[model samples]
Target: MTTAFTYSTTYLLDKSHYIETYEASVPADNSKKVYLIAILLALVGLAVLMLTEINAFVAWFIIALGGLEVFSIRFKKPWWLARQLISKAANTELTLTIDEHGISSKSIHVKSTLAWTDISKIEVTENGWLLYHNDSKNYLSSRALSDEAKAFLTTKTQLINALAI
Candidate 1:
């Protein structure tokens, strides 16, 4: 089974808009968690060191590590960090094409197009439907699509499935 949908950012964005895709969802909440955890860990470590009266060198090491962790979480480049973390955590492939004209996609071995023959499976998820690729193990998602686009896509998928069967 194969299905296809055309993706274009032009409909959703302005001239300055850029399309960005990650192999995984951006951990929008991770930064806050990082900050909280770092603060707590650093404070706890400092308190323990002070109570235990650990050697200066050991205390410095602990403090330094904690500070480093905090610094990294606070100042690290989010785009680069997102790429690295997402790349490592998710093996899925994602491609996002953005230009003045519109947006396009070619993910999971499926070429970017509006044609229905390019899709394999469409399974609904909490956010949206997961569109599978017939030629590869990778998957693409419809989470970013608007209601109108999703409806259009659903219709296209049904048409494709009908033809395929």
Candidate 2:
């Protein structure tokens, strides 16, 4: 179901981590494009060096500049974690499905089942709920959820607490 949510501290943390992980994992495609351009420029510089009696110092400078561009372009920050955070905020899915197929968004399939038992601990923070998964050090932020969604989650939390009691 479509749920409107607000950004909270937990959401920000999860988003930051997700973005950092994603950024660290994959190099940006733009960097590749820039590297290609740098290589082309270097080739042109080489040709110029061959044709003209370019000063040795100038030739070396050109090559070094091109090399620097290529290096910088090849190494770019990954934004997977930020992407995940934004994706969740942008998405209307309210429930995270955990089943035999693994974790899936509720928007994808209603048949997907989510069990509360999957989480290691659930606690309410200053702004939202922290859902710590059993295996991962990362946590899910319920801060981005709308008031209605928060209420629903609160009830679920209460139910969980009651069961524990």
Candidate 3:
């Protein structure tokens, strides 16, 4: 005889969870990178202008483009979160079901299922777990999962986090 383990939880995704998920997936922005690239492009444009004499106006235009990058820095994480709030992410009701077979998730906007074989990898972050498949991923906050569910994930998905589990 075989016994199966099944667990499910339904909760509303808070703003912080979305922020955490975004932070985990998105690379941290280097504020100086924009300035560095702008400076280099301006220098390169200036050099090419000096060398080839291909329209001095074009070189100045390239230099002028730097202002756009500087302007974009204002739209940072909070700005993104605000947009998300205005759109679909705010107050999303999520239902997560996990069993011996795989994981299933249903939210206000989408529903998805991932078998154990289909889950390529599992990453345990400080705030949550990121379940990665092909091109997309699902985020589960640490608080959303029970200890038993965590153990099951450890066994099934190769989620090895000595400190977390």
lDDT of each: 0.51, 0.52, 0.75
Better of 1 and 2 by lDDT: 2
TM-score of each: 0.38, 0.35, 0.71
Point out the higher-scoring one by lDDT: 1 or 3: 3
Q: Flag clash pairs in model 3.
A: none
Candidate 2 residue lDDT tens string, 81-121: 33555563543344553222223344432333335676555
Candidate 2 lands at a TM-score of 0.35
Per-model root-mean-square deviation over C-alphas: 10.0, 12.3, 4.5
For model 1, what is the C-alpha lDDT against the true structure?
0.51
Q: Please provide, for model 1 over 34-127, each residue's C-alpha lDDT reduced to its tens digit, 9 standing for 90 to 100.
A: 6776676677678767888767667667667778887776655554554545443244354554232323565554455323345565544444
lDDT of 3 by residue, 1-165 (tens): 978999999877778777887887666777776577667777777886788768888877876766555555656677778787787747988899999778888997879787876667788777777777778777767678899988787676464333234
Instruction: List residue ranges in candidate 2 displaced over 4 A.
Output: 1-33, 78-165
| Clashes in predicted model 1 | 4
Window of ten residues with lowest summed lDDT in model 2 = 4-13
Candidate 1: clashing pairs of residues: 2-119, 3-119, 8-103, 9-103
